[model samples]
Target: MTRTDIASRTIAAPVARVWAALVDPVALTVWLPPEGMSGRFDRYDASPGGSYRLVLTYADASAAPGKTTADSDVVEARFVDVVPGDRVVQAVDFVSDDPAQAGTMTMTWQVTAVEPGTRVVFRADDVPPGISAADHADGMNSSLAQLAAYLEA
Candidate 1:
């Protein structure tokens, strides 16, 4: 099996609160986008087998062209599973003309109740070749940091 990209953070909040941020579309939109970007979901459903289309826009696209357009990248994803406070699994694909970026990436987020808070572990399986490892890692870490702040605030 190909090794997955992993990022984790221990948030200063309970499992239930942290879980809420993961499944709530409103909360997700606030925190899911990495630094230097913002996002909006065209449609979102958190239930098992539900699907969503999210468009993430860079603050300054001239620096980094998006996969779907000059300024925005679309993410088409389906919820593979939602285990409430435990885990949320999704199959994700980028809407991009670039063949190197075309593939279903399995994103698994697992949560564990820790001493001071909830430990959120994010794993990205089958990451598309077009995305560099460093870039993906930074994105994951950025999102995790945002998640922590969103919950602790």
Candidate 2:
């Protein structure tokens, strides 16, 4: 099966700034999640052959005892190509206790310096089955909006 998904957003910032926000651990964690959520990059090596992980935590307004409304992750990612201020490609595999999600995915990001600012195109390949493409699209759009807000801040 061939799984391909692409999403794009234009930010009011230069290509270099957008690129930095994407690869920089501090900047990424600051804008990764939605406004209320918090995130952190456990280990990030923004170079080819280097691996990293990101952990995102969401708050649950209503959680009873013994119930959890948060999710944490350690996605193993390695930079495959890094073109400073232009593009980046990374291979990421979800690390979970469940055997079902053990698969590799490639995420490619291309930044074009447009008139207003920068246009970023994100393409994710080899998405696992059972995951809805629509959901991913929506999430990417939401994330892009949040990223724009972060960059403007």
Candidate 3:
């Protein structure tokens, strides 16, 4: 069976600002990684059919092995759809030799204008078996919090 995970947050920012944080490489570098990790993008293009690569490193060397390797996770992603201020969809795959981690995952980020701000919803479909749903949700929530802090600053 395919696994899916969803996370949502309401941020005190306009849809345009939230969308910018979602697509901008610099902003992503600041907020995309979860707690205890940092992210660097090798390439990022926020257009349909555009591809990007990113590496996430754990602050603690003793952290568990990532989907791709020990202490780090590498992702190759292609933009499947991009709608400014509304949504972005991407197909993602991890650079892993482990069969459990070798599959295409679809991630959708949907933004909607709320009374006081914007609501961002994240949906991850076809999650690999190697990823625990609770952990993924925690990471997603952490990233959203980071985005909110960055935008509200």
> Taking the tens digit of each residue's C-alpha lDDT, what string does model 3 give over 1-153?
999999999999999999989999999989999989999999988889999999999888586667666888999999999999899999999999988888999999999999799999999999999888888999999999999999989
lDDT value, residue 147 of candidate 3: 90
TM-score of every candidate: 0.97, 0.85, 0.97
Ordered list by TM-score, greatest first: 1, 3, 2
Worst 10 residues of 1 by lDDT: 1-10
Top candidate, metric lDDT:
1
Q: Give the C-alpha lDDT of model 3.
A: 0.92
Over 4 Å off in model 2, which ranges?
A: 34-37, 61-70
Sort by lDDT, top down from the best: 1, 3, 2
Worst 10 residues of 2 by lDDT: 61-70
31-128, model 2: which lDDT tens digit per residue? Answer: 76644456777788898888787755656533311111235445678999999988889998766655445578898989999989999898889875
- In angstroms, give how far residue 84 of model 1 lies from its true place: 0.8
Cα error, candidate 1, residue 77 (Å): 0.4
Q: Count the backbone clashes (under 3 Å) in each candidate.
A: 0, 0, 0
